[model samples]
Target: MTIVDVPGSKSITARALFLAAAAEGTTTLVRPLLSDDTEGFAEGLLALGYRVERRPDRWLVQGSPTGPAAREARVYCRDGATTARFLPALAAAGRGDFRFDASAQMRRRPVAPLTRALRGLGVEVRHLEAEGHHPLGITADGIEGGELTLDAGESSQYLTALLMLGPLTRQGLRITVTRLVSAPYVEITLAMMRAFGVEVERRDSPEGEVFDVPPGGYRATTYAIEPDASTASYFFAAAALMGHEVTVAGLGRGALQGDLRFVEVLERMGARVRVTDEATTVAGTGTLDGLTVNMRDVSDTMPTLAALAPFASGPVRIEDVANTRVKECDRLEACAENLRRMGVPVRTGPDWIEIDPAAPGPAEIATHGDHRMVMSFAVASLRTPGVTFDDPGCVRKTFPGFHEAFAALREQWQGLAARR
Candidate 1:
């Protein structure tokens, strides 16, 4: 198989769309990723009355994220949490009525901190179903932002959501975080929002339990989406466990995604790491040295790290990842269960997990519809005997080329077991 270079992931796609829509003028996104979740986000903007057209390979977005100036519309966010979570605050800034709703799975994802923060911004939010969550009936006439207290235990997205919309209100917002984890995502939020048009001042407590986002709307501009480092973790694991070297390209030197730290994890675990402006290369050294790491910030990359753990020499322990529960699935538990089925020693708690290396066994991994779970463990099949993942198609939520890319890389691993 030839080395195939895939586009970025839907996480980058959705954020780019928000940034583009927030900016004025005809913004063209080149070589952009197209998928269910990103497509849903684009359509949500259309529902809010933005003119977005998708050509064969590029998206032509024409709108002034001043967002809906002439009218008000109600948007149902479906299962796109990026849309459901971020757009509400955007609507509040644009001074439009945005009724946010999601599918059963997305509805189950927590949105309380975001909603509470919006209310504190003086944007009235009504929960159509569960209290403090989504399918929210957002009636916005713009925010009279002042001070907001946010509980971001569920996810950092909540705080990021507030920061993105804070700049649009009359009194700019000051967000005080109650209990915040996954702080890197907030950094991502600030980076994107700043690119789009908003300026924010952030202050964090020692443990990251508290944060502040100074009130200001995002500034709009031509922003580029980097290749997803989180998505690249799977392929990195494949290269480190199997006999091949896999390189994922298109990320920049100063790329803002937090999951870019995956390289650090691989380097520490004894893989030879090579860096470039557009790509990352990881190769296995055959022998491994496991290490214990705190993943409170890079929790999303932990799944892929765990996938590679079974190939290590010592025990690998990951702690401070309670936020994994609010993601597309309960990532920590799912990773542990799948690893155990492969005969790896595993232990898990609410906020931590441990895995020991062994001769990996064969098992059918249940992905529980989480894309990361499917992609991470699929690479684990390289060193392990094998794994058949349920709902393998779940990878479409973030990466459509995952299985194909994983397969192509494995072709170089001289004695790789056959993929089903």
Candidate 2:
């Protein structure tokens, strides 16, 4: 079995930074992800006058229970949605005149639901450029958090931001989420909050799910991040597509990430999967079966499945992933377009995509500057030679050395095949 070590979780790293910044005392984060999105989050913290020490293997963040140190600052959020949404909420819990902006791509993405929720909680939030979008301003004395309803249908980051902000509020927060997508991420948030010394009470209400976060902020501690299950999806897909036995270390049945459940999909598609406390393995059985799947919760792995679908014996249909449209790009169309470029038959709707079985040919993948697009098609290229990306380096958003790492794995697999 080929053992692959993926980078630390981006979601965990981002949340860790937020939690550490909001907690009392210093926080040591071991194996934090170092990439454009995560780095941008750390930099935003610095811009807000939070102390962050970056090391080769870990990160040190000084917490301030009251919030950002800077009274006035302009935080450029880069392309990270966490940085864009979470930082504003973090700033709102402090005394500051903070203006936030982002890249053009990020600027197009909506932050309205989050901003509106913040406004309802008695925080002064202004849309500087477009309503409910980034390029916004917050004049905050502090939050007096109370009951509020939210719609997190387009993105879960809105709910995550509010959930993280709960402790910093005056009266604490009673959040009633009217609609939520990607529920597993909320579980990660709650688990991490418990680690940092706060417990959020969750229960079902008539309206929706209710989360009760009490007053008194978090206490800092040492945290170890897990390997990114989303990033590992590419490698897992590679194994299933190429009929290799691949094991990803640091991810087991107990992994906090819901994306790790992508293996179950592979298992259903004829791969032999083994899950244990230490790691998870996927050994392709030289057969791939395709079926319809709803990917609303683990939607991040949708692209990886799309790239692997053409090799399956039947059509692969992915549904309930409409939130993916508002991500770095419209992922459904992007996947459909790229598969078509490979000369595969594909169909798409508002919330689903279907790929008919065919041998994909070489094509230039248009990445739209979205990192997942480049990485997904790179997996497709393992089978279809001469496949190239219009913007290969866009993967710097999550994995800076994805091409190099994937190439190494390809070489290793080839050598194993040769020996066999």
Estimate, for each residue in 84-124, the C-alpha lDDT of model 1 and write its tens digit. 88777777767656677787778888888777676765668
Q: Residue-wise lDDT of candidate 2 within 207-320, one digit each (tens)?
A: 999999988999999999999999999999899989998899899978999999999999999998999998999888889998999999999999999999999999999999
Candidate 2's displacement at residue 361, Å, is: 0.6
Error of 1 at 174 (Å): 2.0
lDDT of each: 0.74, 0.94
lDDT of 1: 0.74
Off by more than 4 A, model 1: 1-4, 69-74, 204-220, 412-420
Identify the leading candidate in terms of lDDT. 2
For each of the candidates, the C-alpha root-mean-square deviation to the true structure, in angstroms, is 3.2, 0.7
The true-versus-predicted C-alpha distance at residue 397 of model 2, in Å, is 0.3
Span of 10 residues, lowest total lDDT, candidate 1: 208-217
